[model samples]
Target: MTKSLVGYGPIRQTRVGVSSSRGFDSESLGYHVGQTLGYGGERVYGRLDVDYDNKGGKFDSKGNRISPDVNQTDQQDTESLSVNGSLGVELTDSQRLDLAVTYYKDEQNTDYGPDYGDGLAVLFGAKPSLKAIDGANVENEPYTEKSSVNLSYSDDDFVGSGSSLNLTGYYRDEKGRFYPSGKTAGTQASEVWQANGLTDTATLKKLASAATFVTQSEADIEVMGLRAAMQTETEVAGKKTLLSYGADFERENSEQTYYGQDLNTFLASNGLTAQTNGLTYNGGPDTTIDKWGAFVNADMDITDKWHTSAGVRYQKLKSETDTFTPIYEQLLEEYFNSPAISGISAAYGIDYQAGDVEKGSTDHDKTLFNLGTSYQITPNDQVFANFSQGFTTADIQRALRDVRAGFVVNSDNVQPITTNNYEFGWQGKHGDTAARLSGFYNESDKVVRFTDDYTVEVVDTDERIYGVEGSLSHDISDKWQVGGSVAYTRGQYDKDGDWLELDAVRLTPLKGTAFAQYQFDEGSNIRLQALAIGGDDKAFKDQQKDPDASALPVTGYMTLDVLGQVKMPVGRVDYGVYNLLNKDYLTVYHQTTYGDLNRLPASGTTYGLSYTVDY
Candidate 1:
């Protein structure tokens, strides 16, 4: 009974590798197995991979090992595994069906280690007690789990000559547990004054004496989608053409749950009524999103040297979130409105009466379009341009977390982001060299940004980015070849109509890369590459808000790398030395999480070696 399905024997391979690095310490081990076999004259393949990577430690300019910052990999200190397989079969002469399934898990431990933060505010004439929610964020393991299943069917003659239809269904689920980032800048000496507007030494000490804690977060989502598409070769304008249309429906139920623990004293220090259960609260609402869309596109050859394509899509989206009253906000409102507690609040510059909890839902129906064309200027040169539109909503949980009681969430705060993109590019080859160049401009009506404290910034306005990029490769000779690429971009968003620049996360948009390779006669080659990142000091400091709380300046730096592969008795051994120049530079991440204290530097130099062969 077991011998009939497989028409041929299985082909299998196994891979094993181990790597370690210093400066910024990291160690990893990997093992993988893959197999392909014939099932009834068709092929089916499956793969399994297991990996363990412990990424920790940072370095200073002097190459001294140091503790990583909160922005770095807190504890990727565990093992991850994944398994996937695919199968395909022919249902008829013109019909086919395919199925695939995947599963992955990454579970790891976090050693929060004895709460540390007392010495941070020493420069401000105080010692702040910084603990991770009194150790709640500590002594816990975090993990990510994901699984997916996909099935597809296609028929070339479903509607007769020159017509086809394809259908697909997919389902996926993802779950994750994450630890707290770190205590806010208020606990750090440099950002103490910015946290509390008070400048007096006495009040500074009072602010520092307050105990601060962190939060723990968890989220999960299950999504299912179905799609149907049809294509037919037809003459729309008496020209050779193809038209395609598709409709898709996607529904996902996602929920985010956030909880934190803090002392009752901490609440009282901020003029908020102490919660009966402390500061533990659901930071946002549980949410579900339903979306469906349909699109039609056409491709036409207007002439021998010109081509054009265009499409439009209609989308219907609805998001619903549960109503939840934050414990801390409720406690604050209680304290503020109570005449009995007025004196306690007035001592801290009491504000007006805070209102009840806020929550709402948002829905949208819109149509989007995309257009593109290309014209050939010569056999080896052509230029193309396109315009496209994208639409989506901001993070619902974040919007719920930062809601104002009196404002309407559905109408104002929780709005969809609509982005418009324009791009033009040229591709060509001259002699033994080939080149490509492109420029693009993009604008989004709404975007989200985060500060070091994990507080959310709902842009809700316009974010515009424009950039130009180009790459060139030349065969200097048969044995020597060189290529390089460079790109520059400028990004800014409207904050209350005052356009502000983007920060380091992705906005450090100037970069250049160059590589040169030397080939040996036996198909072995060694390549050298260099990367240069331009400094960005304008965006972070240009606003002139609070010096200590803002991101630090990033200086330009360059690093070189060498890679080569040599054939041996067993297999082709691939080796590489990264950061060959050993340039010591601080990562943009180290500065963006929080300011000036305990910044992390990049790795000095790293090496890697691996080999693979068919059996």
Candidate 2:
């Protein structure tokens, strides 16, 4: 059977590779393997690929090893798998059908260490009895699957001999899941507020050993959509002209649930056993979103050296969320009425009530437009300018989910975001060298921002960003080449008619990369690259809500990498070394589960080697 397939003129191709390396901490071991297959013929073709990787161990800033926050028995780890495939068939010379599918999954065991807010006593220079909880951990797992199919038709001449037409239609479906589970130790509430300032060591130690906390959450999302487009081209006034139109329809659904519990509590030692089973639950019905949009555009070459184009789009969106009573309300009600809990409730001045939970829905319509022009500078150079308007509806999950008051708030009246963008660019090539430069300015309103505490809300002020980017590449010879790129950006947001610098994560002011490569005679080559990131001018302060949060300052770092490939008789070998200098740096800052600033550690020196066999 294999011999017969090869007799058909090499209709199939395949390649496979395997590699092993270490994670950033120079301790965790990581391994990966991948394979790709391709098939081609006169009328049909398809391709498929799969990849998997996994790693273990954890590291903190300052090059120290650390364990996960919740579990002393496990180490922080990550594993993932990806699969993709595409198939296409040509029914005729003027028609074709294509299909594609993708699947991906990632599982992470994260260590959160100790609770962030357990140091209030230490911060005040007072030695209290409650010991900090140790070994906190969370398991975060997310996965997605998507598939799409399309059919296309084209004709050299449709209604007139001088005009051409092309049409296409496509459908896609996507689904995903998010689940997080964690555990922690609880702090003593009474020791921190002792009236006598006793400094009693026995009391503090007993308080610390009284409780254990656990949490779990789950979210599922699905989106399906269909789209179609038609385009026509002809000669007008002895120049090229084109007209195009398209429409899209989509529906999305999201479901979310959350739970929290205190597994063990020794409040019974204080004659308060009524709250031993501290259970909490927050969830409701699913959120549904439906949206549709249509667009049309026209383009024409006004002259031999000039061209212009214009387009407009109209979109309509509607979202609805179901409501239901939270499970915690029922549990709280039972506790409130119990005589055994009366003394504990009075000691803490506890008062609780559930708010009205009702269904919510929103609908809106938006319009967007764009215009562009280009001028030929020479035979190999051109300059272009464009202006466009865009809009995006608020995320339905954020607008509808109210799992907890401070964790996930519900905002039914959230508005959409609108932005205007202007851009200019130039590109040219001369002999063995090529270059490009571009600049853009963008302004937006009703920007939705997610705070550190896992809450999402719309900002009232307007925001603007401007940036410039450039790239250059040159071929010194058939064996050697060099290239580099640079980018700079500035951002500001309006507050009471005042402009303040934007403090978001992706606002790096300056960044650049340069690389050089050398080619060998037997299809082997080596390349070296360097990357530079600039630090922020000022630190970002928390919104004054989290007293324990540290000020976040952007940190700049540089790294180098080397990659090479060598040819063999039946296969090829490839190798690469990353962060060659073992630079201890920070990649990004994130909000900890406790609403405090947490710095993400960058990988140190690591290397990988892989062998590939092709058929």
Model 2 vs. true fold: TM: 0.77
> How well is each residue in 227-294 modelled by candidate 2, as lDDT tens digits?
76667776667767798888888888877665453322212111111121334444454778888899
TM-score of 1: 0.81
TM-score to true structure, per model: 0.81, 0.77
What lDDT tens digits, residue by residue, belong to model 1 across residues 263-301? 333233321111122334555677778888999999999
Cα RMSD for predicted model 2:
7.3
Off by over 4 Å in 2: 1-27, 58-76, 108-213, 235-238, 265-285, 324-350, 399-412, 452-454, 539-551, 590-597
Q: For model 1, which pairs clash?
A: none
In order, the Cα lDDT scores of the candidates are 0.65, 0.59
